[model samples]
Target: MPELPEVETVCNAIRKSIKTNKIKEFVIINPKLRWNIDANIKKLLSKVDIRKIYRRGKYIIFNFNHGSLIIHLGMTGIVKFLKNRHKVNKHDHYEIKFQDNTILRYNDVRKFGSIHWAENIEDNFLIKNLGVEPLSDNFNYEYIKKISKKRNVVIKNIIMDQRIVVGIGNIYASEALYMSKIKPNKNCKLLSTDNFKSLVKSIKKVLQKSIKAGGTSIKDFQSIDGSPGYFKQKLLIYGLEKCACGKNIKNIRISGRSSFYCSNCQK
Candidate 1:
């Protein structure tokens, strides 16, 4: 699935190109997605100007004159731009054609992605309950410490929770834990204030680095330009069986997601 960095990459890649474009039409090749695309969405967005493109959590938000379009690129989704005359492929489920003869297409092989309309993003159900962005000022060490002190779950699971902190996916969770020298499965209550401080710093550092590298292309993630992300080459231990410390990296499942860590390097 596309995480925060990947989502942000998509948002940034298409923002300048799509902004101020006049929407000529909206097409739903299929309405069967993780959430069904509303039938009235085409009429709602007809001929509106695209004000902006932004990201909140893993969802891409397309701002318009009267409302917003929220898109979740579930597991195998990629949003890209193409010519208005471009041929539609098998997985191209949604599209918006601009009067400039360009098209913004959303393709998802797994059909887990979704498109929804919101009068105001702040009042939308999907946007209302999201936690703080990892790169924002609100996610500093002090804030992380406060949230960590209240959780008894494994620190890995704690950070992965969308409600606790948004956008730390499985790969990032492992890398950040390894960077902080904190074991993935360690109970959150066992971590001291200093540990939380390090963890917060590691989280921010790893996320920033990943975003800079264009995000990790583990499976199906890709930029809007049909290019894969480069961060996978810099992974520390997410898919490795051995660590640089000459000790075997451990693989464990927490909350049914694979977590990698060096038993020696991490506590």
Candidate 2:
């Protein structure tokens, strides 16, 4: 699945070309995705001018004159802007035609991505519960400390929880834990203030680096321009089971998700 950095990259690329463009039409290739397309969406967005594009967690918000269009790029989903009409692929779920004749295509192999019309993005259920953005001022060490006190979950799971800190997915979580030199299996309550501070810094550093590198291209992720991210080349321990420490890194399952860490370095 595309995480925050990948989503933000798409948002930026789309914003440059699509902002202020009038929506000429919308085509829903898959009927399952048009649950309320006609009644709720068409009435709200047809011919509306796109105001701006922003991201909340992994979702992209296409702001318009009346309501905003919220897009979640679930696993195996990609949104691209095409200069001309082309043959639709098997998973092309939605398309938005712009007044300039340029079309934005949404393709999802898993059909898990969604598009919804929202009057106020902040009040929407999906956007309401998301935790603070890692890049925002609200996501400091103190904030992490406050949330860490709520449960005895592993630090890895605690950071992965969207309710505690949004956008820290499995890949980034492993990288951050490794950077902080904290064991991925450490309980949240076992983290001291120093640990929280180091973890918070590592989270920000890892995420910023990934964004700069255009996000990790693991599996099906690609930028709007169909370019694969290069961050994977810089990974320290996420997929390196026989890491450089001469001691093997352990790959364990926690909360049913795979976690990677150097047993020698991350204790």
Candidate 3:
């Protein structure tokens, strides 16, 4: 699934290509998504001007004058901008034809993605309850300490919880824990203030680096231009079985998600 960095990359890519453009037409190749495409989505979005594009958590928001369009690239989804007419594939489920002949196409092999219409983005059900953005000032050492103190689950699971912190998916959770030298399965409550500080810093550092690298392309993820992310080449522990510290990297299941860390390095 595309996480925060992937979603952010999509938003930036699409914004640069389609900002200030008018939507001449909206086409839905199929309405069957994770949630059925809203019936009024076409009526609300077609012929409107795309004012801006932004991201919240893993969802992309396309802002217009009167309303907004929200899209989630659930699992095997990619959004691409085309300059000319091309062969449409079976998975190309949604599209927006711009006035300048540029096309924005949404293709998902699994059909797990969704497109929603919202009059006000903040009040939408999907955007309202999401926790603080990991890269924002709102997420800091003190906040992580307070949230982790109340959870008995492993630190990995605690950070991965969307309500406590948004956008730390499986890949990032493992990478952050490795960077912090904290065992993924260690109880959150057992972590000291210093440990929480290190964890918070690691989370931010890992996220920022991945975003700069255009996110990790383990599988199926690609930039809007159909290029694979280069961050995977810089991974320290996510898919490796050994560590630079002369220790084997352990792989375990925390809340049913794979976690990687070095036993000798992490406490």
Sorted on TM-score, best first, the list reads 1, 3, 2
Alpha carbon lDDT of each predicted model: 0.88, 0.84, 0.87
lDDT of residue 226 for candidate 1: 86
Expressed as tens digits, the lDDT of each residue in 22-74 for candidate 2 is 88878777645524244457556667787777888888998887778888887
The residue-level lDDT of candidate 2 at 252 comes to: 95
What are the TM-scores, per candidate, against the unseen true structure? 0.96, 0.94, 0.96
Candidate 1: residue pairs that collide: none
Model 2 regions more than 4 Å off: 33-39
Q: Which ten residues in a row have the lowest lDDT in candidate 3?
A: 12-21
lDDT-superior candidate, 1 or 3: 1
> Which residue segments of model 3 deviate by more than 4 Å?
none
- Per-residue lDDT, model 2, residue 222, is 89
Candidate 3, residues 108-192, lDDT tens digits: the string is 9999999998889889998888899999989998998898888778898888888788888889898898899899999999999
Better of 1 and 2 by TM-score: 1
- In candidate 3, the residue pairs with backbone N, CA or C atoms under 3 Å apart (3 or more residues apart, or in different chains) clash, namely none
Model 1 misplacement above 4 A: none
